[model samples]
Target: MIRDIFENAYAAGAYSLAGVVLMAISFLVLDLLTPGKLRQHLWADRNRNAGILVASNLAGIAIIVTAAIVASDGRLVEGLTYTAVYTIIGIAVMAVTFALIDVATPGRLGELMLHPEPHPAVWVQSVAHVGVSLIVAAAIL
Candidate 1:
């Protein structure tokens, strides 16, 4: 029983670490797609558009990770692999979505993130991120 407990704890820890790493990757992806320094905009400037976009990206990652973990069904290796793969796919899709939006819209998407006022486009992009994540998550299941 104790061995089983230890194994479960280890699995949980591993999954958690994987989730955090994937989230970091997602953050970097978003940072790359946005203009200026993301940290500066998020921390010092406290830009609401950047904040909303980032929050949605992270939440999308969480949703993907959760779905991957659930689909693993107690298989650690498979879970980690799926989590990473799905998260990467999610990030790529989100980036492409951003690019598409930029093309279809009036101004540069990345530059708009730096705007002082909250832009409606940012909200649309944020929803797209979560929507793509949900599709990926559903695929995992």
Candidate 2:
């Protein structure tokens, strides 16, 4: 039915917009936690460390989006609500995980993430970020 298709399209669009907005919010939160300007480091300097961290942040968001889609079970209202709720949770967990990792390591993760030096430790942290996201997504499902 055309109406069904339209509704599905609208739901998808809404979720997509929500995902993007959540990503921005996550970015701002992460930036605030760190020392340097994330935008400047990521854009002007093209710092790979920052880039890696940002990528990890995106992976966290992706996990929530996937979980949200599954939890929604093809319902528009459920999809929107689940995605929104899970996104916030996912971001929060990710920040906590990173902070914990920083505490365990030699230096602060927020500062380490912005460091221009490319190190295996950051890669490990990035993977951990994704790992935490998986756990959060699994809990949501």
Candidate 3:
């Protein structure tokens, strides 16, 4: 019984590691879409708002993955595969949605990321991330 428990724990660990790697990749994708490095903005520039938004995006991805794993139950391989696939799709959708938002708005989205002040647009962006995440999570589930 202990061995079974340990094996399940190991599987969960592996899948969680996969999720973390995917989130890192998603951050890179997001950074590329913007004018500046997101990590730089969150760290070097000390942009709290940017940090908040970026953190939310990461959380959004995590939420989807968590839901997927739960839905997958004991099927580790299937669960990890589904999580990775859906995450990639979610990232693509997010990039496109971000671009559309930039095009539809008055100012550059990248510039907004650099802004020291909090913008309503960031809130909207956060909502967009969650909305996309929920849809993707539902699909995976």
Candidate 4:
């Protein structure tokens, strides 16, 4: 039974990780396209926003874990439903994270993260998110 639970969690985690990757790519592309003022307003202080992003990613992982626990029986329909729900939740979390960064920062989010400025902290947070997502995915699969 424990093994079954772990397996379900792993599967859920995999789907959640995939969703996170897609969202990250979309965010990076959007940031690249946005102009200066807007960028500054959205994501100026990488330091301040990095933590929030990490927190959001953690929240997403937690949701996946919960779903996995709930669907440990390996019911195909339930698993699919959980995946869809978790993906939607992840997207919502990403949106909220973006909004929070936009509200807290100065100019535009895209411009700020793209200004050739080196923000190791931001990168670290992003990497952490990716790692967590991957772990979750592995648990699910």
Candidate 5:
């Protein structure tokens, strides 16, 4: 019984590690899309727009990871695979959406990332991230 418990714990840890890696990758993707270093904007500058966008991106990744784990049905290998693939897809879609929104708008989206004030464009992009994640999660199910 103890061995079974330990094995389950190991599986859980594996899934969690996979989720963390995927989340970090998503952050990098967002950092590349925005202006300046994300850490500087988020930590030193304390930019609300960057914070909102990063928060939404992380939440979206969590949604995708959760859906993948649930759909895995206790299969560790399959769960990790699904989580990684879905996360990559989610990131790609979010990047493309960001680009499209930038082209459709007046000024540069990257410029807005460091605007120091709350911007409607940031909120729209945030919603887009979460919305795309939901769509990807639903597809996983």
Candidate 6:
């Protein structure tokens, strides 16, 4: 029984990881394909630091999705409702957390997320998003 559970969890985690990789690649491609005008207004011109910020946000989403998938134990059909709920909750939590962190640290978070700097906050937010996703996924499951 224990072995089975572990195997299931491993499978789920692997699935989730693949999803994360796909999402990251997709976002990167989209960023590359985006027009200079829209990109400037939405991402570049605003702060000239949109790349990392956008990447971090995308990374956070991937983490949340992964957590939800892992929490579902690979039972996507059965866990559809749980995944949706957890995704919503995870997004909300991440938004709030980012807001608070931004307020507390000023441009620090933005610099790391928006700029090309290595921001620990990105990891922190990703972890939190994943954690919340897992909780909500588990509750629904």
Model 1 TM-score? 0.96
TM-score of 5: 0.96
lDDT of 5 by residue, 12-105 (tens): 8998998899899999999899878999999999999899999999999999999999999989899889999998999999999999999999
Q: Give one digit per residue, the lDDT tens place, for model 2 in 50-73.
A: 888888988788888888888888
Which residue ranges in model 1 land beyond 4 Å of their true spot? none
For every candidate in turn, the CA RMSD to the true structure comes to: 0.9, 1.3, 1.1, 9.0, 1.0, 7.9
Residue pairs of candidate 3 with colliding backbone atoms: none
Give me the overall lDDT of model 6. Answer: 0.54
Tell me the spans in candidate 4 whose CA falls farther than 4 Å from its real position. 1-72, 120-141
User: Model 3 over residues 32-63: C-alpha lDDT tens digits?
Assistant: 87676777888898987688678878988998
Off by over 4 Å in 2: none
Q: Which ten residues in a row have the lowest lDDT in candidate 5?
A: 110-119
**TM-score head-to-head 1 vs 6, winner:** 1
- lDDT scores in order: 0.93, 0.83, 0.84, 0.52, 0.92, 0.54
Deviation in angstroms for 125 in model 5? 0.4
* Stretches > 4 Å off in candidate 3: none
Query: What does candidate 2 score on TM?
Result: 0.92
Sliding window of 10 residues with minimal summed lDDT for model 6: 29-38
lDDT of 6 at 58: 61
Which of the predicted structures, 4 or 5, would earn the higher TM-score when compared with the native?
A: 5
Show the lowest summed lDDT stretch of 10 residues, model 1: 113-122
| Per-residue lDDT of candidate 4, residues 1-115 (tens digit) | 9998987688767656754664454455434444443335345644344344445455555556455545546565566566655545444544455556656767665445444
